[model samples]
Target: MDPQVTLGERERRTWAAFVTMRRDLEGALARDLARDGLSVSDFEVLARLDQAPGGEMRARDLAAAIGWDKARLSKHVTRMVARGLVERREAAEDGRGQVVVLTTGARQVTAAAVPNHVAAVRRHFFDLIEPDELDVLDRVLTRINARAVEG
Candidate 1:
């Protein structure tokens, strides 16, 4: 690739539209969760934990599951602990490792928020996609995610 080469108009517009749509949709989802006293990040963490066996996971595994690095997961989980949304427990198996556990409050909140979140997702994203475009979008997203993982 040479610096002299530049993205032409269609490429530029496509990139811009993709960026703007992601930003706007993320903001809309954040607002939807905000009404339920959850941030997008918080919901992501709790949602992963909620799905894990026994409503808990090794802290390291939880971090990996949610694609958050340890420090960020640790800091966010600390805040969640303070709010009683989750708790950190010493792992029963290893004793040295930590486990993240979802609280009763988290279960109740997610039970309500999940449906609203789905509706919001459909409203903002899925509803707009033509049925025929779904396959294309899926492949493109898979490639993009693969590239991200590789890099």
Candidate 2:
């Protein structure tokens, strides 16, 4: 193997561990949310909307925040709307654009879900990492997120 072209054995092992840990964490969280009638995607959308200014955000912004494509977000919003979890209103500034507003029901769901979600996060994520390692992880992830946004 070319030394310059290949990952060292330790690097390869570390990457594998990271990937497996991420997948397992996501799977466990998804299962926990499922019990509350939410998938990971649903939780993500709700969480974003809940935090938006005035509990509302542009549909495009919501899509960007959740990393969903326009069409996929449209479908998800439609379903959420039907369930009384969200509502769409024509943008006052731009008639062609739409805003998604979290309904009272949605806020209620998030208020209930957040505590449980945080507990799940604590159990499945934070508890597994030491405090010092968390600082390192945060710095690494923030750098990666910045790069992704720039890209």
lDDT: which candidate is best?
Answer: 1
Model 1 agreement with the true structure over 1-151: per-residue lDDT tens digits: 6645988788999999999999999999999999988999999998898889999999999999889899999999999999999999999987988999999988998898899899999999999999999999999999999999999
In candidate 2, position 14 carries an lDDT of 94
Cα-based lDDT at residue 75, candidate 2: 96
Off by over 4 Å in 1: 1-5
At residue 12, candidate 1 shows an lDDT of: 90
Which number leads on TM-score? Answer: 1
Model 1 weakest 10-residue run by lDDT: 1-10
How high a TM-score does candidate 1 get? 0.95
Model 2 lDDT, residue 116, Cα = 87
Give per-model TM-scores: 0.95, 0.91
Query: Candidate 2 on 61-144: residue-level lDDT in tens?
Result: 899888889999999889989999999999889798899999998888888888889999999999989988999999999999
Q: Which pairs of residues collide in model 1?
A: none
